[model samples]
Structures are given as structure tokens and as C-alpha cells.
Target: MSLELRSVNYPRRISLMRNNKSRLSGFTLWEVLVVLFLMGVLLTSFTPYYGSASKHVRLQMNRANIQRIEGAAQLYKIDVGTYPHSVTDLVYSQKGMSDWQGPYLNEIPSNPFNSEQSYQLDSSGRVNNSSAN
Candidate 1:
């Protein structure tokens, strides 16, 4: 009885291995190629939407930068009884507002389009406008 059981188990194990091997033979070359091609097409189709989203995010950042600068300069203006002598004054001036609380922004805002076009103070020797060209 024991010998018979061993023989049966041995064949059963071999049959299971053969079944696994056959299943692993799996997809045909054409099927694999079709799946890869479909994925490539999907990636290509999604690229433009990703690019647009990225562009929108950057533009939104630029707008936020403008607002931050405007707020800081306005605060400085209120404190000193006038706007800073220059944008650099925002950075260097210790004699700002009495209620003046801040390093206002971390770094000066730069125009996302033209790095050369950072936020500027309209130094007409009067009130500063952060949006001046």
C-alpha cells in the first residue's frame, strides 16, 4: 500500500510540473509585441496632456510669485510710510514698518518666462510698484 502511494505521488508531482511549464510558455510573440505596442501608443498619447499640466503649474507659480512680491512691498510701504527705495531695499532695509513682520519672501521673485525679468521695483524715486517692466 505504501509503495503504491509513493508511485502515485511521484507521477502527480511530475504532471503538476509539466502543467506549470506549459502555462509558462504563455503568450505568443505576436501577443507580446501587440501589448508592448499598445503601451507605447498609450504613453505617446499621454505626453501632451502631461506637458500641458506642467505648463499650467509653472504659470500658476509665476502668478503666486507676483502676489508674494506685491504683498511684501505693500507691507514695506505701510511700515516706512513709503515704499522701499528699491527692491533691494526690501532685502537690506532694517528700518521697515513698525508692525513690519517679515523676511516677507524667501527669495526675490523671478519672471518664469525671462529669468532676466525678475520682479522689479519702479524706482521713479517714489512709491515702488513691483510689476514695473
Candidate 2:
């Protein structure tokens, strides 16, 4: 009886291994390449939308910076009794006026649209996002 059991188990194990080998394996190389190509096509289709969103975010950031600079210039005018001649006065300590209590801004920011352009102040101390002219 023991010899018969061993003979049966050996044949069963060989048949199981043959069954596993015959079963369908995972994706083929061609299938993997097709999936990668599809992903690339999907990404390219969304490229224009991503570009527009990025531009919108940049424009909003530029607008916010301009507003902050304007507010700082206004605060400087209120404390010192006159509009500053340039935006630099808001970030730099002016000589001789004890009321000029600022360093209102830690640093001046450059224009986002064109870095070569910088924020400027109009005669009324309003911030302008353009080259000084």
C-alpha cells in the first residue's frame, strides 16, 4: 500500500507541473509596447490644456505680487507723508526722516511675464508691471 501511494504522488506532481507550464503567461512584449504607446498618446493629447493652466497660474501670481507691492507703497506714503519716488524706497531705509520707519518690504520682486521688466511706481505711488519710462 505504501509503494502504491508513492507511485501515485509522483505521477500527480509531474502532471501538475505540466499543467502550470501550459497555462497562459503574463502580457507579451508586444502588449507591453502597445500600452506604453497608448499612454504617450494620452499625455500628448493633454499637453495644450496643461500649458494653458500653467499660464493662468503665472498670470495670477504676477497680479498678486503687483497688489502687494502697491499696498507696501501706500503704507510708506501714510507713514512718511509723501509718495515714494521709486519702489526701492519701500524696501530701503531713506536718509533723514525719522517717520520713514521702513524696510516696508524685505525684497523687491521682478516681473513674471518678462524678467527684464521690473515693477515700477507711478507718480501716485501705484505699482506698474512694466519697464520704467
Candidate 3:
């Protein structure tokens, strides 16, 4: 007599595997929204810090430009025996001032915080920003 073995049925096991795979395939809508919300919160928290940092940087740039103008003025005084009569004197030759050895500065820099304003020179030979208090 010959005997044959029967194949085992695994319908429940196959169905369970398919269900687990479908559930794990991707994130749910709520999960995605929660992640987006967290990212937005982080960005809002950093916005003010970045804005103030940019303002501080502009202020520092203006200060450096002022110092540069002051040094150029001092150089002009040493060469001409007088402080510059105006900011323009540093960049151009003045009438009857034969000792001037400039264009001291290539060009005057505008106030970093205010594009419409320019730096100023005081009678004491110091440079200042008129609009900055």
C-alpha cells in the first residue's frame, strides 16, 4: 500500500501577516499633522532672536564705519595741519589745501541702520551718526 502526506492550511497566519503589513506601511494623518505643528512652533520661537541679531549686526557695522571715518580724518589733519572742514574733504581735494594727500576713503559709507542718512563730522574732529541716539 502507498501513502501521501497532506498540505497544512495556514489561512489565519497569512491574513494576520497581511493586516500587520498594511498597518505599518505609513504614518497616519494625525501623526503627520503633529510633526508639522511641532516644527512650526520651533520656528516661531527662533524668529525674534534672529530679528534682533540682525539689528545688532547692523549697529556694529555702523560703529565700525564711524571709526574708519575718524581715523581717516586724523590722517588728513596730520597732512594738512587742520581737521577736515567737512566729510567731503576726506574724499576730494579742497581748494588751496596743497598738503592734502587723499582720497582718504574711496567712498563714504551710509548708515547701516538708515540708508537715507550719512555719517557726520563734529567740530571736535569726531565722527558720529546724527540719527543714532
Candidate 4:
């Protein structure tokens, strides 16, 4: 009976192990690109709704500010016997207005729609947004 021992091919075994390790290691380029594409699509799809939601919030804040100004004006009228001539009058004393009891508001709130402009006091003693027209 004869016993035979064969030499192992070490380089070939190493090469095969490396190949298998690479295949199982990480995501392929195509998979990463697909995930990025899907994320971009989701962001684009939600962008318009996000913008409208923020605008809706601004509109609601505008309405609330107008209501606050209206309430202050009513208080001013009760004290001074007339509506304020301007929004500034609510936060400062006016000349020749002896009945003035204000500083009704801490400060005049800027118009939400247009930050550069202040809220308008209409001829009817109502508060409005000039930029809205």
C-alpha cells in the first residue's frame, strides 16, 4: 500500500478567500446610488408641501398679530376717546392727547407678510396688511 501527500496551492486559496470577502463586505456602487436617488425623490416630493405649510403658519401668525393690534386699539380708544392715529401711537404718547394712558403695546409688531413694512391702520380704525392688497 502506498500513501500519497499532495501540496496545497496557497496563492490560489488566498485569492479565492479574498474574492469571497470582497463580495460579502459592503454595498456596491449601484446600490448606494439607488439609495441616494430614492432619498432625493422623497425630499423633492415633500418640498412644496413644506413651503405651503410654512406660508400657512405665517398667515395664521399675521391674523393673530392683527387681532392683538385691534384689541390694543380698542383699549386705546376707551382711554383716549378715539382710535390711535398710527400704530406708533399705541406704544408712545401723543402730543395734545391729555387722556392718553398708553404705551398699550410694548412695541409695534412688524407685518408678517412684509418685514420691511409695519401694519396699516385703516381709516375705519381697523388694522390691515398693506402688502396684502
Candidate 5:
């Protein structure tokens, strides 16, 4: 039978070609390397002075705070006739408040450098002369 037989396979190839899809997402190696280099440059610019300036600021601030505490204590002594035995005595009346002019300074001074220890006080409630170092 020499009847017309148009190729059936030809139509299936066209359908398969229509179904294919290609899409791309995510950073290439070059893009990731560029981002890392930019971060490194920024970090290097600020790193040199970052540490010293922070320390200087802390030390100066602590010195000023200690000075303020010293002044408050002087005022307390003038009114009470003697410094309290320790810093705690200022907060709670240990000896007597007959002449106590405080609650001097709301509470007590705190260490600016390490909050683990408060600004040191001597046996008496005065600032410890050696605490800063």
C-alpha cells in the first residue's frame, strides 16, 4: 500500500523541544570573591586605631568618674565628721546618720573598664588610691 504515511515521529520531537526550559540562579565564584575582597578592605581601614581609642576613652572616663566620687566623699566627710568604714556604709548607715548628708551620689561609683568590680574603695569609703591601674 503506497498510501500517504506522514512521519508520526516528527511531531513528537517538536513537543519535546517545546517542553525544555533552562534557568540559572546563585552567585558565580567571581561574585563571591569580589564581596570578600570588599569586606577585607573595609575591615583593614578601621582596625588600626579602633583598639587604642576605645581604651583611651575608657581610661579618661574612669578618671573623671573617680574624681566625682572623691568630691562627693569630701562633702560627706564635712557633714558626718568622718569617712564611712567602706563604700557600703555610705549606702546604709553603718556608724550613724545624725550628721550624714547623704544618700551621696544616688548609689556608688561603678568601674568603667570592667563592671565585674566596682570602682575600688579603701577600708574607709574613700576612693582606693591604687584602683585605676
Candidate 6:
């Protein structure tokens, strides 16, 4: 008998075609590469701003440390009647000041910008310092 297989095969073939089209509907390789390049460009533009912000934060920390050291020195002077000859003297006993109450700071802090460089105090107890980096 002559059977009409055309109708049955046509519907299956159409469905298969539709599925293939749907699978291919997403982004192509060129489109994905373009998106990645744009993102790189956007991030690079903000790099300078991030660099300057970090430097500013380091400088602020150094200034705050100097202020703290100066305050502790002033307190030591008030109690003992003169500024200590060095920063360590603030945290340790000198010779014979029975009234000395100190260890003013738990420990000396190094410069934030340069760990190898310690803060300097002038006759006036100001911080003038250098950085290794």
C-alpha cells in the first residue's frame, strides 16, 4: 500500500529546524570579545584615581601618628618638667623621676609610608621624615 509519510516527516523536520534556530540565538564570539574589551577600557580609566587615593590615605595616617606622638611627648613633659631627650624615654624610665608615669605609648610607631624609617622629632618635636619607597 502507498502510504502518505510526507505529513508525518514534515512536522518532525519543522520542529527540528525550530530547535536549531533557538540554540543559535545567543551572542557570537565577536560580540563577547567586544564586551570584554570595553570592560578593560572602563577599569583602566579609574586606575589613576585609585592610586592617588591610596597615597592620600598613607599621608593622612602619617600625619595622625605625628600628632599622637606630639601629644604623648607633651604629657610626659608636663609630668616630668621637660621633654624627654628621645622618643624611647617616653616609654621607659630615665634615671630618678620617682613620679614618672609612662609607657605613654604601648610601642613606637614607624612611618606608614616607610616601615624602615622612624619618625623624627626636632627640638620643637615636629615630624620631618623620608620614605624608602
lDDT of 5 at 18: 63
How far in Å is the alpha carbon of 23 misplaced in model 6? Answer: 2.4
lDDT for position 54 in model 6: 96
**Cα misplacement distance, residue 61 of candidate 3 (Å):** 1.0
In angstroms, the error of model 2 at 42 is: 1.2
Q: Give the TM-scores of the predictions, in the order they appear.
A: 0.63, 0.76, 0.72, 0.76, 0.64, 0.74
By lDDT, the best candidate is 2
Flag regions of model 6 displaced more than 4 Å: 1-18, 21-26, 94-97, 129-133
Off by over 4 Å in 4: 1-19, 95-98, 129-133
The local distance difference test score of each candidate is: 0.70, 0.84, 0.83, 0.83, 0.71, 0.78
Off by over 4 Å in 2: 1-25, 129-133
How far in Å is the alpha carbon of 115 misplaced in model 1?
4.5
For 1-133, candidate 4 gives per-residue lDDT tens digits of 1222223556667888999999999999999999999999999999999999999988888888788888889999899888887889899998888999888999888777779978878755698656442
Worst 10 residues of 1 by lDDT: 124-133
Instruction: State, as a TM-score between 0 and 1, how close model 2 is to the true structure.
Output: 0.76
State the local distance difference test value for candidate 1: 0.70
Q: The CA-based lDDT of model 6 is what?
A: 0.78
| RMSD to true structure for each model, in Å | 5.5, 3.7, 4.3, 3.6, 5.9, 3.6
Model 2 error, position 69 (Å): 0.8
Per-residue lDDT tens digits for candidate 5, residues 1-133, read 2332336666777777666532145677989999999999999998879988998889898888788777776777888887655565556665646888677777776777777776666645567766665
lDDT, candidate 2, 8-76, per-residue tens:
899999999988877666787899999999999999999999999998887887888778888998899
Please write out the lDDT profile of model 6 over residues 1-133, one tens digit for every residue.
1346887788999999999999899998999999999999999999999999999998888877888788988888778877767677767887888767897777887787878787666666555554312
Superposed Cα deviation of residue 16, candidate 3 (Å): 11
